[model samples]
Target chain A: MKCRKLKDSLSAYISEELSERQMSRMSRHLATCSACAGELASFKRLYERIDAVPQVLPSDDFEERFWRKVKDADAGSSSVKALPLFDWTLGFKWGVSVAVAVVVMVGAYFYLHTSYGDKARGKSEIAEMADIDRYLEFYKNYEVIKKMDFLIKLEKDKSLGDNNLPENRTL
Target chain B: MRYDRDTQLMLAFKRGDKKSFDILFKRYSVLLINYIYRFLGSRHKAEELAQEVLLKIYLAKDTYRPKAKFSTWVYRIATNACLNELRRHEYHHHSVSLDASGEENPVNRKVWMDDQAFTPEQSMEKRGFEEAFKEALKTLPERQKAAFLLNRFQNASYSEVAGALSCSVASVKSLIHRATVGLKDKLKDYII
Candidate 1:
């Protein structure tokens, strides 16, 4: 196998994850290849150095501190449970506030909607009434309005008659 | 037998046996501390986080189910705790001042180098390597770091790591491989 392929298999080989056939092939390659063998040794050494890093231990009173935390947590949880009424009241207050806000919003929406609808209807009614009044006023002067054209023709004829006079005539 | 013991102890703890809970704590506290230390690179933070993990285990006893090994569950919790702690701003901002003089200073805390009997030169070399390794470890992606640490430090099998990481075994292998490559590349200068 080429060194590149052998290098890819090096980690699995070092970790002992390679299959027997692959492992044997890798072993053979490493035997013949000095560079691959050196790489493997370096990997092994790195692993050893990593393994050699010392483990840090907890202090002697780790248990004591842990149990104290447990006790405190236990006490805190119990004290929280002790205020059942307060918890319920808090929930109740939030519910009531949300309900009140929702109700106010809904009521305001309906009120505004109804008022707007009423105002729109009232405006249309007033417009209709105004149209009726206008029509009535026109009808009230219907005869006079109907004679206006004749009156205008008579005035035109009179003016024509006046114009026929020499002083009023355009040459 | 080892597998069953932890599960059994957890079951007993769930059944209100306080002593069983104590036994579980005593058994895993050091391991959890060490595991978290690898992630946080701070012994103080690791101990604090380990305490939190134990507290979580204690409080969550009622929710315990025997679906998997108890160690896997513990590790899952510890891993999550470490990740959460890493996410905090304090974790990124905090530094260990070696010359700092205070009880609260992480530098004053006991470290692995303190307990080892080494020549001064050897100790300095080990400390240097450890610091370099930690820096390289910090550069790894979270999942890769978790997989590598669980597989290498915790001695968890790839399958166990997968279970702890909530990923498939294939993904765990990929994560560990990638982490190893990354660490190797970063620590190349230090490695002989």
Candidate 2:
């Protein structure tokens, strides 16, 4: 192997990642090459310098805190699982239910308000007609009446057809 | 005994054994926390993320099938956790400063470097070289840092690195190559 090739493989050689044949070739080259040998030595020292950085340990409370978290998580999960199925409902579900309720209420309100107003107006018209008929019958019992002084709506107006009647027109 | 103990402890943890989790935490949290701290360069964030990593392990215990060695699995988790923390820190435009207070300044307290730096000129050269080396490392991409740390510091083989990093062995070689070239250029003054 040339020095360049050896240099390329030096880290691999140190890491034992090179193939056996490549390792053998690099070893042979290093034996005869002063420059490559020097290069390898320098690399070795640099590696050692980096390795000499002391590994820092965690704080004394690290393990205790870790276990405490674990226990809390465990307890939380177990408590969740132990609760009744109806004990929990997600926010989205609740929002959907509220939305559905508002829609139904609005629909019902419009339906009832329009229908109730039409029914009440029809009942009041019928009551006014009944009162007029009662007055007409009561006045006929006397057989005589003043035309202007005792004015009465004594009969239904038959000029309008049922389909085109003004009483049924809403607007 | 260590492997056996770790395996048993993991198995027990998988079975919802709290004591086993405590043992695993005791065994690995310090190393993992240190690994994250060095990678992220912040004690506060490192501690928080390290706790998160351990918590993830606890949550994932049931899913761990032991297809790989336990140590390898845990180290892979630690490595990924640190990388994520580093990326997050970088995204926020933060630089890591190793706060050396009082007796903690390793360079000033170094006996070997002191002996070699007999003159002011030599001391300047040494300081200049070390600074350049650190700058080069700082400029390295995340993948290169991961490859360098796993390959050199953790003594992981290419295949193991590939497994840990979820990359091909060939990719591992390329990453290490790039990292070594960068480092060599950085430390050229000191080395050559």
Candidate 3:
């Protein structure tokens, strides 16, 4: 009704966004008010100038160039998909796995080197004691072992097909 | 479900009909280029973005549903692309040097102001009008500019603009209203 409200609606009025009731009301107001009519006229001029701005067309190769880009994109995406080796995510995964493995390995090495060394030394001492016991047992029966060694060597010569050797002479 | 012709064409492409896509392309290419050109004020960028929109529609064949009009979907994509570009740079100004080389330059746009039919005086007037129009266009916020361009130049309805902008029709009404008023205030000097 008032010019302020009507002024706000002018844009919608010119563009036909208003409902029919609003349109008729505004139409009636415009007919009575020269000031509103002048404002409407200038807004119309704005529309005309906006509409007059022309379009610029793409070049002749537009479609062709677009198709080419599509083809290149298709190629690029396919190649990336096909090769897991070329995938950055895959590389990242492998890198994380290797880092985790290295961490575990270093952790294991430190754990073994520090806390397990005494256990390993204890084991080696037992092994050394067994060796000593084995040598001591042979020395305890030194004469009998020497005699058994001669007999064992004769048995070995017999099994070696050395029939002509003195040890292999059964008679 | 009933679909618009373009949506049907897209569905047909989804069904492995490449010719349907060709039809859609032929239908939208020029219309889209003009819309983008008007939105971005750059011929080269408009052409580039139009191609991208087509490519997106092509790629979306399998995923597209008849949720909205094909035109609405298209304008949405085009709008998003234009907004991204505008947001990337604040678009400090749009200057056209008539002496500059053709389409490669953003400001070196080809316009009908250079029509041979116009007398030199008329051409000069048209030139001034276009310059003021461009400057006025840059002054509006990006969303207002988008709504104005779609509603004014693209012949989109308030509902259609709302669909494209992902806003309500009431918002579109307000946006377009503010845009028109803003442009009028800024261009008052040159229009008369």
Candidate 4:
């Protein structure tokens, strides 16, 4: 491999990502090359130095303070949720309105069904009217003659009505 | 079982389990805070950013896909949080090195296989070297610094680095290389 290629491959080498074959070729190049070898060594040393740098602990109460800030931020966001409860009330009002509508429908059904219902009304009315007409016709045909006979008898009696007239009666 | 436990834990959090969320926060907070601290060189900012990352996990638990390792996913979130926080503060505009010299820096105590192996003079010399070395680390570009720290300190792969930075693997490689080259140049005088 060329020096440029080996230089670029140093990162992958440190990371152990290069395949065995590629590693071998790069090793061979490094063996023969002075500048690349020095460069690789320095890179390795730098990696080691960075690793050797002591890990620092966070300050006392750092985590606690951090969580406090997070809580504040979260609380800030949740406060935004407060305004939408008004919209929730609107939704509840809609639910109450629907319930009222259902109650009104149920009340109307019973009121209209029993008080003004058309149950057996037509048959009874027709039967009563037919009976009245039949009675009238019967009276016109037979009873009228019988009544006329009685009226004639009464008229004959009326000829003697002057004799049958009570006192203080006008004939 | 581990993956199941984690996924179950996340699902529980999704169902409004604050205890599950607290468990997750406590579980990954140190590593994530360390990752951010290394990136931005500020423990205070790192801790703050770590909390933000946890909060995001809390909010985004519903959409989290468990196809990859949970650590990978959380690291992705942590790194992004650190980056966003750093950007908001514009910390990159002025480089801040976290290292310090001598006994004044609490973290600078030397590791000793044997305490008698080093004299006070030798320890002082080493401390000076370490301080200068840290000074050199500040010379790298901000992206390079982030790439280097995430790759070396976190053992992040190029693909993972790319994932964290929203860049391609090739670009991640270039960033690492440039970072290494910059460090190498700064430390060339002391290399054996």
Candidate 5:
């Protein structure tokens, strides 16, 4: 491998992540190339320095402060939920009020219509009964008038001739 | 069985056992803080970010499934939190000096000398090298930095790094390789 190619693979070589064939080629290149070998050594030293950085610990009150923050967040969220609940209650109240007003208007319309219909029906029935009574009175007067007409016809016949009126004195 | 303890502890916490959460917090707090410190390069910010991450884990307990390893799940959450923090600040401009003279800075207390027994001059040189290494790390792109940190510092395999990063293993390898090349270029002064 050329020095450029070998240098490109240096990270993988140092990390031990290369395939066996590539590792063998890189090893051969490094054996013959003093500059690449020096580069690999430097990478190793750098890795060591990176690993040697110290671990820093937090303050004594870290846990206490963290829990306090969590509690504050929970409180804030609950208050946010309360605002929506209030809006929902207000909406429900308005909806119910509008429904009651609509129902009352419909009921009043039906009640007025039914009362007018009942008054018109009662007037028509009174007119029909008066007509029936007037017809019955006219029928009774006609029967008396017909009997008078028969008696007048019998008197005229007796004045004309007694012989023409024989054996019919009951007429 | 290796991860059963943490898994059970997480499951218990999911079931509303608050004390189990405390135990989980104690176990991973320092580790997560240090990991975030590496990403942000500031102890104070790292601790704050770590607390946020733990709080997220606590709040999202119901979403936790024991299918994957507990450490992997926690690291995934921590990784996302650190990335978000980094993006929010447009990259932490406050550089933490490894050689800052203060008794409180633990990084300054633990020197990174190559030899176990070093003279004062070697310790000072190692400190300079560590500072340069940190600077080089800061220059890397976020994903590459995450890949390198998880692979090298956290001792995660390429596949595990992929899982935490939500990327393929091949992508992680490419990222770490590019990061290594970048670091080698930046720290050429110390190395060669």
Candidate 6:
């Protein structure tokens, strides 16, 4: 085996997971190639460092806690088997939230876009109220101007006998 | 015994022998804790998740099957639990230093003991190397990390790792190789 071929097998070789024939080939290559041997040493040291990591033990009450959970599981319902099976519950929750949001949005759309929400109608109503206020103000200022300008013009036209009114004209 | 020691025990429990289940628990609870602790890098999380696995095994008493080794089955459940958790949450690697003699951490507090105790400088260097190893492990993809840890550290044979990971032996080999190379790249400074 060339250095390149055996380079990739270094990890597997150290792990002894390689085929016996492959392991023999790599062992021969390592004996011949000083570079591969040093790389092999590096991989070995790395493994040693990893193996040297101290063991992490559980708490003193680990057994007590585990037995308690077992008892609880026996007494209560069995949900562990159902854990991965209920992925639909998450989808269902999202569906509900989206539905509620859509309903609110549609309601707001109607509220803001319907006939009752017309800005034109609101403006017209405001104008009508303003016209009534104007008239009331003028009537308050007038002494007895019960005869308005249009009414005076009509009366004068009748007194003068002017029956030939302009076409499409209205009195 | 239909299966290995654990499977026999599981089958015994299946036939109304609760004491067998107790034996299984004693044998695996700490081992599972240690395995998950390395996988998750959190002792508390490992302890909690190991109990969850135990609960899963206990629940399997009634409907247990001896398809594989009992340890393989338990590790399958554990690996799934760990992977599911990793999917749900981002794992932050918390590596403890050896120099913190005042640390209340159990892993850091108890270390290698010898007649010639480690000097403070040597302790610091060891701490750096340990943290670097953890960081390197943190960089591996979840499946690759699972395969490597199972084979190199957890004493699972290649076929056992395959069973636990639900993959083939070829894939386990490839994953372990990639993980080893990744570690080499990350720990190049300490490789000498």
Most lDDT-accurate candidate: 3
lDDT of 2 by residue, B84-167 (tens): 555454432432221211222333221211222233244346566444444455555555666677777566778877777667
Tens-place lDDT digits, model 6, residues A1-171: 468777877878887888999999999988899999998998898888788888777789999998888778775554644563565666688889999999999877766777554453476578668989999999875733653665577678889998754466443
lDDT of 1 by residue, B50-135 (tens): 99988988998898877788899899888888766765544443432212224234443323222233433453466687877776
Please, what are the lDDT tens digits per residue for candidate 5 over residues A43-107?
Answer: 89777766776667789998889989999988876786778756766679888999999998887
Residue-level lDDT tens digits of model 4 in A19-99: 899889889988999998987888887667666767666677866876777788778767767666656666788889999
All candidates' chain B TM-scores are 0.76, 0.65, 0.76, 0.62, 0.72, 0.77
Q: Rank the candidates by DockQ, best first.
A: 3, 6, 1, 5, 2, 4
Fraction of native Cα contacts reproduced by each candidate: 0.65, 0.51, 0.79, 0.49, 0.70, 0.77
Model 4 lDDT per residue over B146-181, tens place: 677778877778887776666677777787887787
TM-score of each: 0.63, 0.60, 0.64, 0.58, 0.59, 0.63
Tens-place lDDT per residue, model 2, A35-126, is: 98887887787777667766667777876777788889999888867764544654557779999999999877765676565464566577
The CAPRI class of candidate 2 is acceptable
Error of 1 at A20 (Å): 4.9
Cα lDDT over the full model 4: 0.67
> Which parts of model 2 are misplaced by more than 4 Å?
A84-171, B1-5, B16-19, B90-136, B188-192
Clashes of 6: 0
Task: Tell me how far the alpha carbon of residue B59 in candidate 4 is from the true structure, in angstroms, after superposition.
Answer: 2.9
Clashing pairs in 3: none
Q: Mind giving the per-residue lDDT tens digits that candidate 6 earns over B1-192?
A: 446888998889989999999998888887888788777777898999999999989898888878888888888898888766664563423333211222234432212122124333453477687666665666656667778888876788888988888777877777777778777777777766
Q: Which structure among the candidates has the greatest TM-score?
A: 3
TM-score of the A-chain for all models: 0.45, 0.46, 0.48, 0.44, 0.45, 0.43
Better of 1 and 4 by lDDT: 1
Q: Which regions of candidate 5 deviate over 4 angstroms?
A: A1-6, A19-35, A74-171, B1-5, B92-127
Worst 10 residues of 1 chain A by lDDT: A162-171
